[model samples]
Target: MARESDEVRSGTLPQATGGRRIAWAAVPEAVTAGIERLLGARVVGAVSQPGGFSEGLAARVRLASGGGAFVKAASTLTAPAVAAFHRREIAISRRLPRTVPAPRLLDAYDDGDWVALIFEEIPGRLPAQPWRRDELERVLTAVTDMVRALTPSPVDGALLGGPRLGGWAALANSAGIESGVVKKLEALSPWAARHLDELAALEESAAPALAGQTLLHGDLYPFNILLTAQDVFVVDWPHAWVGAGHCDVVTLLASVSLSGMDPQPIAESHPLTHDLDPAQIDAVLATHSGFLLRIAASAGAEADRHLVDMMVALGLASLRWLRDRL
Candidate 1:
């Protein structure tokens, strides 16, 4: 018998598992009908993607006609503002550069109360947790290769972060003001409570310094990256932005560190960040981690039990990293 992949053996692939994802069987009739109409085939079965913190329905669905597509659907009940991001993603993905490694958008569905999106399936594996150096290098290299296309981002539509791509200020400002948010932050780590004010300021300062036209994949964690033999596909565009180069690298750096890998050298070794100021990189780290902490602090952020657990784990880790880095 052949040996199993380490991800199977170690069970440490950085995927979003254990969330309260709505079953495809339970999705609204109109939503299911819409997906069927888009593909011209009835959905026979669905295998949910086990990553990320969204409570929406994300799965690879098999059609009656032997076809498949990655489908994600959300409603106000499952997620609050994420449905808007799904809509935003569809619009932006359609206009992304072809050379970029994102999957193609096949169709979109909206029945007033629910929204769904369909995309070409990405057949690949999540990068190993603790990140294998070779795989980490491969993704970093891919970012460098695609920079020419990613820069001068084809899409100009405003994303969640606005022009400067700075949304963490709101989260930072919530500290001390929101008693509930404070309790959660203190529970995760006292350090977060200690320096949240400064973290907020640092995030605000970094926003203006983020000067570039590149389409930044604001959410670049391992869960959003799909690695196939031929390519590395970056998925999830709801949080994308048109901002400074190597910002994704900064996001990925925090992700790597959270997984127990030391990505400090990646910052200097990767061509994407080779010439960028270290202070700017630090700013990214500080704010990104703070944002994660803010999410972890928020009550009822997601309905999925596992997704919330994943957020809490990563959120605390990100906060700890910020406390140590700053």
Candidate 2:
């Protein structure tokens, strides 16, 4: 029998449970009223969507005019980080090429403390867990298409760099093995503790390997992807960044590995990574693993336990995958 954490490691548990969400009705009346004015229709009904780690509003709202739209709103007073993410998403969504599969941003509202965005609601469901091969293929194809469309990113100005790729190096240099992070790593995996130096070196060398002109959906987990009968749509732009195209592919494959499938073959054969140096791929895996570990370690006391568990599982999966490659 497999352990419960094993189910998490394979991507099943988190799919069965989702993050807590703020109900549409729970949003401030003034905020909803403002949203209605922008939508050009009165909101008649609303159903909150789930699956991400934020406690912000994410819902499909019905209009008196019989149309519907997706809404995401957060209060800077309560969730400053989430509000900041919404602000970034608003900026990036405006600049996305028309060809990208993301839903178009219809309207936005920001009044210093509250942020809201309305998007053309996509008609689709999340990709199935245990990942049916056909659906995964469709999503992968869509990801490749998105990468191509986003190359030489259309957005301008200072996009966030992939600094998380340096997590291991930072851990290694911080206060030696007695550091809180080292203690956390040892608690997670003795193997990680034993190989700390090597992992740090691999992650430190990842900077050059990660450089490129492509914009990445930095968080490409299953929750951020939606599948329709004929196409796949990627959503959630809060973490978008410009980097090597393979970085997104690598992140997706790491999530895929949680389905008890071998992601190495796909990683090796995928067009984005197929011709790249094998060592560069290793560096990416190390960087990603370190990144996950760091996030899990630093998760706040108020953090959702389920999401923290998912992060730990995915981090372990990335480490196992990296070990196999080594």
Candidate 3:
């Protein structure tokens, strides 16, 4: 018989942003209760992790069995979008293999207002250290292998899954830049305005090249990977989509490089970066910095402001590197 506990409760779902304090309403209380009952365990502890771009409640739930799980329920302010996003994630995850360095999708529940997903917690730590040569080589090789294994999937822009070839336009549109960032970027140089104009041109030019490609890890970064004892595992699939393979490569490299560390040696040694134009490489990083800043600015929280500033600085640094490239 289906457990009565399986039915999700309405009031228990948290408001958007979870209302500042750690609240129980964000996750569907029924789902939590059901998970514990179904797993033959208890939720010994739980903590809400913040900085989520989407409307979702992410919590680390520790079970009585000494195992833990990450549970989340997403509800975009718009109902249709919430359903679509969840569906996309589920569909794409079904295609991925367990051997690949990614989190396994455990369970999914679509309860109207919210869509909940649970995944077995992968143990390990995020790489806090700088982009060392060995780490860079390892990450590049892993991504190369991951990309090679993917088969061309059908196009579904809503789900963040599609061919890898459509990257540039998607990135240009979604990288999150706005007037505030544009103004700030302009401040970087008298030529900065001209440069942004050039970027606009680049976006237009790159659109044709970006269509009908392969899948990509839309948000690849060291922080997204869990460095375990055996190997590294990538997490955070909310941004996964189909795009040019090089888009993921650029995102990965720019993410590591903008950590305020020297990436020249690592870039030179790694085959992925070895053949690329140094200036072009720098421009990609700069463009991504703007992308990150736009996302951060949209958060509107004080904590988010501080984080955005740091990212803006990184973007500015990338701009400087690119200026030298030009």
Candidate 4:
């Protein structure tokens, strides 16, 4: 039932069994050929992978003569946003010493309608199942440490684009909400509604605080982090901005809960995350819930609605676990 609910909320669930393959319009063949030629190799294989969080084409590209590269290409549909994001990533990478492991920016091209960037491939298996406490601790700790070390320079508004708060505010004021999905969210229990209200408030309150401006990964979740035998590298920097550090922290804690891990024990145990008291975690869940709701306000309204419901429920489920401690 919960899974079904999530499907409805994210708009990704409740679909027919047989679905079409996820893809983008064909990338001009010359793009791949140009990359191979630039690298002094022959193009081998270029298969597209559907990227979540951002609209782009991620290809597993190999060279006839040598190694492989992962190429992310965004069309006019997403180029302006992707270009700004890429610039932020390049700045962050430049700041770090050579030892700090991250994807090396290989090449970037702006072809008007299409903008593409390439990186040397980092190879590893995704976590096959849910992470255990130890793995969660290691991964999350690494993420926090990485964010902590970076002193984000002042971002030129014209360069990195708009404020993080703009994203939420714009979504809130938008004219459309599918009536069918709005009914589902409205039908949710008072507990869910109450939690959503608090979350909306938290997001509004946190928006101003981001004015302080620190560099944040913008999007740091399990799927975005790649773990290799040698090191952990974070990818997808489109959302990177000078914002509140806690935005990054809270986003991560909420993500851990979404991944089906209890946020209590780990939040209590990890020194890095220990600052997130029960109340703070509740607020984070609320903020995170609002985030999913906005994203699903479109065609995936059902799925986003379900995610908001689940997040509210999950936040409450953790409440009991939090009570005795207080």
Candidate 5:
């Protein structure tokens, strides 16, 4: 039964910016055939989902049995990190408990070169942009629910992240930022321009701010979440991390700012923030700001222009949050 949740305004999020998706026809025939055999049905039609950033293929497939399932696949040849995440998703999805509102894993295929995972396709819509207040509230509340249910992550927390989730300390000493990007970062706001160095140092000091036992979606932007009549579903687990209780909260609130929403109050009102310290929260936000700013400045590094554009928006948003509180 579809759970009837609060109703929210409908709108579209920014289109994903990345390389062309690898078509189903492009998948090695043996790989698709192997997946068909596992499902006990042949695939008749397929539609690629448009919201994710990885170079893998994520789509809903119509099976010969007249049903559907979600299939996600990647190869090291395309992007090694994506392939790694696909393998990690297989391991993580298999162990997820019922408490987490994520799609269920049905079958998996990996032959050293390519990895594919079949999931219970969720017929849910992406949350609207210029976000509706009610819709945003549900997602925030859902984060608390997900965190409460996953405090002692079902999987080992130690294997999650350090370099991946909170690698701000490394950024302070790094140097690939181009000149024009730095100028834009400096022009974001008067407060940001005046206090850039301070924010970076605080981010460095809070290097371990992401520490905790909760399994985090780590990247909790709009595209990674889905809203059904009954539940909120989070997808794309390759970036999942073991982090602070409110880590996902920080990411979620920062993202909506791109649509011109004020992030400060939204961050404060959440139940998850009740026990967290203010300084640590700012520290973590600063770290995210640094990461985004740095990524936006990468001139020639291979990146999705759309993702870079969103990063620029999010970096400014995170910085604004810092300016207001710091």
Candidate 6:
């Protein structure tokens, strides 16, 4: 189902990166035994999946029963933040309607410190980098479908707004711009320094523009998406929120730009955004761009190198797209 362009075939694009991962064999015996008890089968084989910035366990496992499942596990002792995310995902996954395209959450286990989620094994691969036109179309169609299905926000207590959705105004304030973070951002792109105030003003309208009832995936990086012959599946829901449906599409198109594709045309014609006001789109883009730049700017020396790199790349891409729109 993958369609790679000549550049991707030649490996010219930066390879995807993630956090250090622990082998499934190294997982605590108690946790593994608990997972087996939940599955009603002994795990016979496990292959780790290394495509996200979580220092936890993500794997495809074969059971002695001859079936397979995707397993994600983390512990407070090792990856407390990731364990918290797992807890939230478990809550959100249980409420997801069957019509949604995410992998079905088969079961979950928690032992006060360790958390694990078991999902139905999906036979799919990450979408090609520097996306092929046809494949991008399919993925866009899938986003539209998912948006339609998630309208009115089925999950209760989901966030209406968060750091990812807003903050440009605060970030543009005098103290903020003078801080090391904004300085770091300005170093990455001089354009950001020149138009900080204008971008902040544009973002003032973002809150009203983004208010909606659709549940957004919030993070739709290519690595979080999987493609099979028949379907596109969005994984990783820790950042999911209830907001404008077009939000996810905007975030995704920004990533497309990061992968070296011009996302303007795709954004112009994509169903989720085609009819929206250009200014509204600009507001959302500003909000997102500010968010990414802030993260990139504030990333600590001990932060995951890959995660920081992606944040900076995608931040620049979103800012570039916003600049073009203006």
Lowest lDDT 10-residue stretch of candidate 1 = 1-10
Q: What is the C-alpha lDDT of each candidate?
A: 0.71, 0.80, 0.54, 0.51, 0.73, 0.80
- Poorest 10 consecutive residues of model 5 by lDDT? 1-10
* lDDT (tens digit, per residue) of candidate 6 on 145-248: 99999998898844322537555566677777677667776676667766677778877867877888888888888888889999999898877888888988
Clashing pairs in 2: 10-258
User: For residue 210, what is the lDDT in candidate 5?
Assistant: 66
Q: Where in model 2 is the C-alpha error above 4 Å? A: 1-18, 157-163
- Give lDDT tens digits, candidate 1, residues 27-56: 988789888999899989999886676667
Root-mean-square deviation of Cα positions for candidate 2 versus the true structure, in angstroms: 3.7
For model 4, the superposed segments whose C-alpha errors exceed 4 Å read 1-25, 49-53, 77-100, 152-158, 161-181, 187-190, 194-197, 208-213, 276-283, 300-326
Off by over 4 Å in 6: 1-14, 158-163
Model 6, total clashes: 0
lDDT of 4 by residue, 1-326 (tens): 01112211211112111121224236677765665666568756776643233345676777887788877766665446655565556555545444344677777766556666777877854432355566565576676666566545344434454433321333334232333444444443333333333334556765444544566666565556777665677777666666555556555554454446655666666664577545554444444545444444333533333334433443333222222232
Per-residue lDDT of model 3, residues 279-298, tens digit only: 44654554464454444334
Model 6 vs. true fold: TM: 0.91
Highest TM-score: give the candidate number: 2
What residue runs in model 1 are displaced by over 4 Å at the alpha carbon? 1-15, 77-80, 159-180, 300-305, 315-326
* CA-only RMSD, every prediction: 7.1, 3.7, 12.0, 6.2, 7.1, 5.5
Q: Candidate 3 at residue 203, lDDT? A: 38
Candidate 3 least-lDDT 10 residues: 6-15
lDDT for 178 in candidate 5 is 35
